[model samples]
Target chain A: MRTPLGKVRNHGAGAAGTGHFIAQRSTAIALAVLAPWFVVNSALSLKGGNYLGAIDFLTQPLNAVGVILLVLIAFYHMWLGMQEVILDYIHRPFTKVLLLLLNTFGLIAFGAGAVFAVLMVNFGA
Target chain B: MAGATRPQRPLSPHVQVWRWHVTMLTSILHRVTGVALYGAALGLALWLMAAAAGAEVFGPTHEFLLSPIGQVALYLIVAAVAYHLANGIRHLVFDSGAGLQPADASTSAWFAIFFAIAAPIGLWALVTFGG
Candidate 1:
């Protein structure tokens, strides 16, 4: 009974559909490289769970920058992926909205805290 | 407003309905590993924060990471990471419009699962023997 335009108006695209898809894939690609690097480096450096070794590794400029980028991109990707999971599964109106909001704010806070921590280590602040 | 009047819609095939298949396992595992890695990511955040807090604060965290339970947790995290990484690459291939064939998808899923099993053991060997 509805017009074609009416049927499609609220359903298609949702404005950011393509953008979300692209960001998720692009970040996945970035992680594909960064993650392996991180795992290998951590294994080699943090042997015996050497705390000073970790500090030493993070203090290097390249390592510091890489960790920072990894944290930022990983958290951003997590935000996007978790949003999809939440939207797909969490059907209750109130819980879905609540989780979506918490997901965003919590990730931002954690991501920022991580980056700040890395910066503090690198800069001796 | 229309909710009360809307007819009940059929839902998509869910886990209980689908036949067991490698692709299905991979699909489910991709999400499961993703959630697991979400927790791992939080652990990463905590590690960074503790490291920043200086040796006095980081001591317990580091000790725990080296303990028996922590090592098991770390191994599981690594396994999840390996699986997620390999399966994530498979997904990227799927996104690129390749490997959509059932056989190919199944093959890749098996490969991912194999890699997940092998990576942690390989790392353990490298650390224990390559020294």
Candidate 2:
């Protein structure tokens, strides 16, 4: 009974890196930079003490930029990071591809809705 | 007989047959919670953008969230947010190169559960009591 050389060899090379691991860390750094400013903006919103007061504060030049930045960064972060999670555990290839497309559309829809909202806030319509 | 016993297996049978571990549960739940949070986040993204945009867009969503079903959805989102946020901090800690030990892994898992549950309760109290 001879043991084959192939049997002695191992099979560990298939372990690979995915986009989620990298993107999550990348967006982690972005969130660290963005979160504090957002906290301050949130506090400011409360301070307005009334609807139009809140509206006026939101319409400020810097505040508008901050809100836009927050939406864009946050959605990008969520999309990329979540794409990673779906790919990892949901092993069926078709389901995985479907999820990827669903996620992409989801992000786009979110972006559109947000843009619409920003337009409403900025233009007061 | 003890020494002569059949050579023990190098690894446990069925990494599948292995006990459902805390670390494993935490790892999976972190990702699961992430998907839930993404839905909630889409809502938040709109809210922020609407805030930027003004009343026409903002009012309806604001009103929607305050409604009964919307409140329930909002509550779930709040729960997801609390768990994800706390678990995220745990990942950050691991990213920093701490908690590599087996004991540390289990400790962190417990911590994740504790924080996940506690944050929501705290938030629930504040939302109900503060308002």
By TM-score, the best candidate is 1
Distance (Å) between predicted and true CA of A53, model 1?
1.5
lDDT of each residue in B1-131, candidate 2, tens digit only: 58788687677547757877788888778787777767766767766675665567667766776678976785566566556666677788888898878898899788878876775566556545664
- Per model, how many backbone clashes are there? 0, 7
All models, RMSD in angstroms: 6.0, 7.3
- Give TM-scores for every candidate, taking all chains together and pairing residue i with residue i: 0.89, 0.68
lDDT of 1 at A71: 94
What is every candidate's C-alpha DockQ against the true complex, given to 2 decimals?
0.63, 0.32
TM-score of chain B of 1: 0.86
Off by over 4 Å in 1: A1-13, B1-17
> Candidate 2: lDDT of B13?
41
Candidate 2 stretches with Cα past 4 Å from truth are A1-20, A32-57, A60-63, A89-95, A123-125, B1-16, B48-60, B124-131
lDDT per residue as tens, model 2, A1-125: 13355644673332334555666677766665564455434543543144566567667878767766767777887887767678667899889989888888988888777766666677765
lDDT minimum window of 10 residues, candidate 1 chain A: A1-10
